[model samples]
Target: MASFNEDGLKKKLDDLNMSQQSIQTVSLWLIHHKKHAHAVVNVWYRELISATDSRKLTFMYLANDVIQNSKKKGPEYNREFGSKLGKVFDHLGGLRLDDKSIKGLNRLLTVWEERSVFDADQIRSFNKNFNKDHSKEKSKKRDHSKYESKSKRHKKDVEEFEEIASEPRVRRESELTEHSPQDSTPPSDPPEPEQLIEALQELESAATSDAVVREKIASLPDEVSDVTLLNNLQDLNAARALSQKVEEALAMLEVYNKRLAEEMEARKSVARMLHDYIAYQKDLLAQAEETLEEHRQKQGKVKKVREELKAHLQNLPDISKLPNIRTGGLAPLPSAGDLFT
Candidate 1:
């Protein structure tokens, strides 16, 4: 594990042109470490060339070493418990190690610690002891607080119900006092208890029907295990699965379309290359042909000149080199020779 200063790491990366994969890996680690991740990434972009092979590998190795070491350090080293750490790493490398491989790594580390290869066990044990003590204290406080809250809520509900129940009694008592019992009092129907119950039910139903309930239910904790909650969850899961399948199909279709587009682009590129190559070859051939014709015409002119000179020389009488000016002097120019010769 290295004590990496962001400045030092950037300097090292700049010295070597690292790839994007390497940069992203380092940036994510900087994030995992809870130190300015994006700032570090920007620094990397500003400093690193992003083209050097060794630079990428270096960042990747350093990041892996740091993360592994941090995890070994303690729970404080762990980020949000359910964070998608694997996805981050996978995206950086453009490769994925499956669940089994990851589990195997965990198992290997556990075995190594158990074998007393290092002081990992002591550190882990200390962390566990402290965490347990803290958790127990926290739970006790929370439980007592929750108990008080429930008691208060129960008292409030009872008071509200009692006030409601007393309203009808007070009305009846006033009516009886206002008129003598059975003294020519017209019979008036009082609201039935069932009607009140029905109205309450209707109010509750309306409240549940509001869109907010759907949102709240959707946000409920995944750990809920109550039977009704579980049933609703299962139904929701089925709907989600169907939606996911539809989304997957759409994604696959998009990929297919993109691939088709790329293939078409590739074909066009090949065609253009072929056209350029053929045009170049054709131009070369035409130039070569023109040159060959010029060379052939020159050769023919040379042959004609030689024939004329030979005729002129043969026409001259055989004379000793000194005597005949026609034969002894330098041969006449082609134009100076007689037409017949």
Candidate 2:
């Protein structure tokens, strides 16, 4: 029986391998673009499957083999590799294009991130290419006036600076002996975006720029045109907000748990006290009944007529004091077992 089960298991494993190979073949065909093929596969499996299975499973096995084989072929075969592969998928999936043709292509190429088959260097290279290509394409679309405008702005700035230098300087009282205020001095020019940008660019281009100046310019906040910079700031802010919210939630949960623990302890204490009180009452009742039995044993039974007559004479006054015979002739007495029962 065990041999039969083992044989069946081996056959199943073989079938799974065949299925996985078939899937990979279809996947490669579906993924028409070689640039993002590996990335799509990695992301589709990585984020979508459990880690242990990812490494051992036959389906992922074929996908992993394909990526490794592609990497060996050439640098051009490198897609967004590694964990970052998932991010590429995330970016593409977020696009709002509802066109059937575009959507179908996206669906066909859809894959999640898989960490097992990741290659970091390949991803870096991919990003470098993507950025270079994107920048080139954007430059091609822009007008020549954009570059010309920069040169014109620089010329105007130099002229303005020369004009300012030609004007007389305004001197304070401390330097009155050497110079005096000149009304001819042109009004100080207010700073503009173009001026700041030009200054920063010049500093950046210089071979021997001041470290402090470069740091200050680089660290200065960006404008709308620098989407990456703005996005980084927004992401930072969002992370901070999420962290604060998580901390607040954890604090509230801690307080609730503490209150619950205190309530549970109080209830336990009350239960213990009630249990002890009931046991003490039972002990006291038992002692009282034992004492009553001892007194009866010491008295013994009445024997003679004279003793009975004497007892009757002794009880005559008490019996004659009854209120009404019909209403109070007999008050029911409980048996010995009634006390505990």
**Lowest lDDT 10-residue stretch of candidate 2:** 182-191
Candidates in order, TM-scores: namely 0.20, 0.18
Candidates in order: C-alpha RMSD to true structure: 36.0, 39.6
Instruction: Compose the digit string of candidate 2's lDDT tens values, residues 249-341.
Output: 556556555655665454433333334333334433564476578666665543356688898898777755776758866776788899779
> In candidate 1, how many clashes are counted?
1
Q: List pairs with backbone clashes in candidate 2.
A: 42-114, 43-111, 43-112, 43-113, 44-111, 44-112, 46-113, 46-114
Instruction: Kindly report which residue stretches of model 2 are placed more than 4 angstroms away from their true locations once superposed.
Output: 1-239, 292-307, 310-341
Where does candidate 1 clash, by residue pair?
A: 17-52
Give the whole-model CA lDDT for all candidates, comma-separated.
Answer: 0.42, 0.40
Clashes of each: 1, 8
**Could you give me the TM-score of model 1 versus the true structure?**
0.20
Alpha carbon lDDT at 86, candidate 1: 34
